[model samples]
Target chain A: MTTTRTPKPATAPKLDPKSRGQGWGHYPLFALAFVGLALFVLPLLGLVVRAPLTKLGALFTTPALLEALRLSLVVSLAAVTLSLILGLPCAWVLARYRFPGRGLVRALLTLPMVLPPVVAGVALLATFGRRGLFGPAIEWLGVDLAFSTTGAVLAATFVAAPFLILSCEAALENVDPRLEAAAATLGASRLRILWTVTLPTIRPSLLAGLSLCWARALGEFGATITFAGNFQGRTQTMPLAVYETLQSDHDGALLLSLILLAVSLTILIALRGELRR
Target chain B: MTLRADLHLTLGEFTLDLAFSAPEGEVLAVVGQNGAGKSTVLAAIAGLIPLQRGEIVLDGHLLERVATGIRLPPQARRVGVLFQGLALFEHLSALDNVAYGLRARGLDKRSARARAHTWLERFGIDELAQRRPRELSGGQAQRVALARALICEPQALLLDEPLVALDAQTRLEVREVLRETLGAFAGVSLLVTHELDDAVALADHLLVLDAGKLAQEGSPEQVIRAPATAHLRAMLSARRTGSTPDPGT
Candidate 1:
């Protein structure tokens, strides 16, 4: 025999009109968003459709393509590492401190992000090339940057460092200054507070910045070719290789293009969790 | 373990000029309405803010003196502060949060965690050691913050509205914990609170501040029996009537 219990009195659940989910009223906005999104994804879709998938295995084994892939990976990773080492302090200074010409310094630092890639390469050459400004002094120390692998890394860094700096600076700005004060009261020194509090607090943004910087460096073309010059197993990255193969071997260029696209998509997907947080 | 502060600071249209002292083993409650420079006074004592003039001395050490241009940084002053929001490190576990001071003072990781664990146990929060700050309830967070402040054995402690963020029930519970802890502490403690009940319950001496100046300073009983300023008189009457006092009045 089942026991019977009295039902408890209940009131109607409140429904907030403002909190309601999407309905017919949201359809126009949703359509516009989809259209805006399609503008970004359509080119990739086109590339995927035209790519020679059947010969992908054979294309991957091409010596020049393999060399370009390896060099691109090495140079881009180096560029990202360089960006972190140099850009983090710059970002920290910009975010936390105020001094003379701060606005001018920030604008100058971010100049390369919007400057044409070719112009950045020109600037790099003018600063570090054999006959360029400071070039003679640099060569005196037995260092050659222009038309070398080092030049490729430098060019990529010139274009990508600003992305990391901007993201990291914004992240630092978002952290509560009171937290640092708390750390100070806890007997933490300036560097200690940065390591345990400030840096950890902004870890997600740092990761986001790293991925963006790496991806930007991976896709660097105009700057690399202009300053470093495309040379197999040396300065030629995937983008430069793809550019060269476009004239002689369309299939090879398509394969290289697909590889670059795949790499960027994978990195973005991996960083989605960090970016969302 | 004594704190002597005479601060004169100017921020825009507002200027703070106040002087007070708290000897060892005493809790001096700095009571004031909002924007009355209560927090600013604490910040100056903690070395977070600079004084335009005047001096702050802790146990004969010159922490700050604008005349001599001698001001020590916060870390070197050995002051522990509990902010209004607690300001517990969100990234760290409860144990690590308590251990932060020990680690910052150059203690090894193993020993710091061990010591931190002991402080957690002292606060009856050993079970929550591995949990992050956001995971703990308000009272638990307060206990953890208190433990963190006491762990370093600071020369002076600064508490900013420690019980203001808690619920009614939790406030009573945490107050008991704080009363016991403060009673045991040998160092000077400066408690900043807006609630008159909190001041009466915790502080040995009371200081009523109005418009960046000291309006009244005495024992809790003396302040209630002989209210000096209009603000204090209003507050006493509001308390007697079981109603919250209007800060503006």
Candidate 2:
């Protein structure tokens, strides 16, 4: 036999009329949102529809394509690693310190994010290239950056590191400094507090920044080509290879573009919640 | 077991210039209006902020001396501060939050967590040790923060509006906990609060701060019997009449 029980009384208040979802006003808003979303979806659909699916296996087997894939992975990963190493301290300083020209310094640091990729490449070359500003100092250290794999990494980092730095700086700024102060009063040193409290508190934003930096570096084309001079098995990343193949082999270019698109879509899907926040 | 501070500093348009001493094993409640530099005194004693020209001595050790240019970092000052926001590390479990200071001082995780478990038990929150700060109720979080602060056995303890975030019932419960804790602790305890009731209830000595300076200091009964400044008079009058004090007055 089943036992009967009384339903609990509703304690929660009713929702306000204005906040109820899907009113007449939503139609126009959704229409515009759909149009904006279609702008992104249509191009991706075109890439998939025009991809060389019949020659997909053959494309995968191609040594040049594989080498470009490997190089892309290497360069982008290096750039991301370098970005984390340099950007974290830069972000902390920018967020915590107050000195003269702080706003200007922040603007200069994040300028690369909005600056044209080719201009960034040119700027990097002017600063690190032979006969450039730091050329003598770099040469004396027996390191050549231009037209090498390292130059490709540097170019990608120069354009992409700002993404990591900007997100992290905003995250660091939002963290209550009182938490760090509390940690200090608990006998934790500055470095210990950073590792334990500060970094853990900003972990989500740090991951988001890492993914953005890696994706930007992976898709970097103009900067790498301008500064590093794309060469097979040397500095030719996937985007550079795709660009060169488009001039001669359209199907090969489509396949390479498909690969990059797939990787970017995966990143966006994985970081959907974090990116939304 | 005494904290003597000569806080002399300027921030923007306001300046904090005061000298106060908190005796061991007793609560000294710092009562003030908003922007009266109540929290500044705690910050200076905790070594979180520098003093332009002052000295802070805790347990006869020089925490800060501007004349000699000797300023110990907060990590070395052996001062525990429970911030107004209760700044518990949200990323860690309650047990880990309580265990933070021990781990910071090089205790092994097992030992620190074991001791933290004991503290949680003492605070009657052993069951909620695995929960995060956000998951716990305000009162539970307060206990966790108190446990964290006291675990290090510091020379001084600072509580900045620790019960201001709690409801009336929870405030009374936590105030009882705080009274018991302060009675047991052998260090100097400075509580910055806005409520006269809490000050009179939990504190042995009452300090009235007005506009970044000390307005009065006496026992709670003494201060209650003789209100010093206009702010104090207004506060006591409001309490007697069961009304809120007027902000303009």
Candidate 3:
């Protein structure tokens, strides 16, 4: 095993021209970026400034607040789980297979994202509410979805699953099919290839998608209130509670808003590194 | 093992019709210029592409038959391929990459890793087993890919430009490694390359393809001495003018 061969010398590091210098022409773009940054931060700053910091402890201890927070956590987590279970396969189909009317299917799947939240609520009701399309069959099964916690979860999932689907599809699309082909040549079945190669390759994107879906579910308001009919300890999540307290208890509403903002910001920050990579 | 392939594939304006066979313990080199369907023939045999109207039988087993609508998947074909780019799993360590086929075939992880280590030792890459593909040099990666392809003891081996990515020194080293390995392998093997030196050095038989058809097929000495096609003649002339004569040539 002994040989006189020498390891090759390390190559010099490449210098990027773009990193060499900053030009004056970039100022306008920087300013525009700052403007976009301000657009997001200003409102958050306003919420923080108007928040009743002294009464935050008491506000947080209120029964309605605690119940809403708990409900929001449960419903959003359930929505995220449902989205991962359902959306991942849908994404794989959209990304890997070619079929007729694929464009139409993708557009329809993403429609809820741009549709008004209240309109989405109405649509859900028309499809699943009592006296609606499948309502009789569901009732025959002794299952009531509308105006229940299940309805709230369904509402959140309807709006948030699209984010997961789109992100996961993009990630799957970016995966090198050659790797899958290589795995197949090594005698791996289709499902095994997906489990060992495809899924691991797109793990970062899956995490990012999960975080986005959960955050969207956590902030769901109009749809849940309209379809689930905000009950005190069952269907009333954080956003619904904020709406209810907005008129009579402005400080309470502010506290709830602040809490939602903090939680969402924390999740986004946690996922930022993964998304960037 | 023996491999018999009669492939007829049509893509848009291009049509590829080819028929070839290789017996056990023999290396068949397929050479052609760009667009001569060299890679296509290998892919068709490997079950990566479907044949429009043909049959591929390996060791008396029908791997593909267009008339009967029978096409076994790549996994069921028991054909190993070393792709032109090697296509090593970039995220896995070299040992893991070599063990992938064994694991896929239901071997336990411990035994697979142990066998992969033995293969790595044979290839003189035992110390580099922990390195990922990106961390390995071109020659090192080629050895890992070779071990991965051969670990399954495939009935047929298809190598697509196996040494084209390496530098001259590394190419010579890898060619010697491949020559020794293929010499000892008892299954049918087909190598696709654009370099005449590769064919002359490693392959027992040569097939020259021109415009999607076979132009010449014979022993390397016969083909090189009396080239039939203009492309073959030009290649021979070019090789004659070159300074260093390949050892096999």
Candidate 4:
């Protein structure tokens, strides 16, 4: 069928933009975009291209590799769980409710996400260290977090919790406050309304936040290593494992890097697909 | 279900200092312009906003004195509100949306679902139970909103710009449904509307609000007979259209 809505091409503008009297030519914007995209993909492409294909299966199945992978999953999941426990409510306060110095609190929350991972590690060490102010007292209560698996989880959490909080805050901000009002008028207590109404409305955002938090936690390098130390079967995550292997077995490091990439990509794809439906 | 509110609430530059009451089964329609604090009154009564100084007595009990914040967190207030957009949960099915208040009140899941189905049936949208709010038409969503609010058997109902979200044709039909629904309700009803026809249809008492104060309050016949302000007159005049005024004067 010939569509009546088809445009008259004969009356269209000239093919040559130069002759059409438009001065537009080279775009710095496109150049900048291309450079940014190249920077993003270059390291990943290098790792894939330089992989030791002959020892790929062996590298993946090694006991040390498997242990590190398991630890990475455990710590990342723990970090994400703890972040949700703290971040969702912190985000609610930021987005919906208001109090004094709220702007300062929000800024401080985001600082962890943007600050260098090494700097975050230093900050955590200063505040929660054995010799630190609140740290010695907590340790005396038989809770030894430093250089333990739990320490790794804490480090990851400190670095990644901001991702969840910021994302969920934006989601909550976009929602109409009227719905909460409507729920209350219906005789639902505050907690009930949160679970039944507020939470579901912001699920897509919460999922996005959780996914970001998990990815950040999984790939955590500097913070985990500095706070918990790199132990092959305990505190060594996939990223830390890759770094340790790089100084000796180049092939092992590349294989482990690919593993980290695969794991994070699989998780994000699954979560995004689940939330889409 | 006689409710009385004597409030002095302030937000930014807008202030609401007014006193009013609506007897049980009475329709109190508040008419006002954009910035006339129409929504502020609803928000304060719903416990979404704070009251500076005054009391809101529902039936006979003081609702404003039990301060955790705004008396009771929205749920405990038991005042049904229909926001301008209806604010139906997009993720929830129509039946679930209607049943939400019931389930939130600790009703079992099975009973909540049954009650929701009943409300849906009452609103004549039973077949659309599984349909999410996003999939519903404007009129259907409004009906679901009505069912959602009314199912809780609230002691009082507050509706803000109920017809604003509907199409011209749908508004005409929905207004008739709202009138029927209001007639069945034994509780007090406060509907805020700019449309004269909608107010004249459902409201027994007309309250004209101007500059954060009650400009006039009287029966619809009296309010329409001599609209107090020029703004009120313009509203009635726009709909005059050669329709003769009642000569019962």
Candidate with best DockQ: 3
Q: What is candidate 4's lDDT per residue for A189-214, written digit by digit as tens?
A: 77877887788888888898889899
**DockQ per candidate:** 0.37, 0.36, 0.41, 0.34
Query: Which candidate leads the pack in TM-score?
Result: 2
Worst 10 residues of 2 chain B by lDDT: B240-249
Tens digits of per-residue lDDT for model 1 on B1-249?
A: 888989999988778999988899999999888888899999999999999999999998999999999999999998889888888889999999999999999999999999999998888889999999888877888888998988999988889988885765677777888888888889998999988788888999999988899989999888877877776677677777876432212
* Per-residue accuracy of model 1 over A1-277 as CA lDDT, tens digit each: 0111122346797798888865778998889999999999898898888888898999878899899999999999999999999999999999989999999999999999899999998888888999899999999999889999999999999999999999999999999888899999989999889999999999999999999999999999989998998899989999999999999988878878999998998998988988999
- DockQ score for candidate 4: 0.34
Q: Per lDDT, what order, best first?
A: 3, 2, 1, 4
Report the CA-based lDDT of candidate 4 relative to the real structure.
Answer: 0.84
lDDT of 3 by residue, A167-219 (tens): 99999999987788889999999999999888888988999899989999999
Ranking by TM-score: 2, 1, 3, 4
True contacts kept of each: 0.55, 0.60, 0.47, 0.59
DockQ of 2: 0.36
Counting clashing residue pairs in each candidate, in order, gives 0, 0, 0, 4
Colliding residue pairs in candidate 1: none
Native contacts present in candidate 1, fraction: 0.55
Chain A (candidate 1) TM-score to true chain A: 0.88
lDDT of 4 by residue, B93-199 (tens): 99988988888788998999998998888888899999988777777888899999888898888899998746556776777778888999999999998776678
Each candidate: what lDDT?
0.89, 0.89, 0.90, 0.84
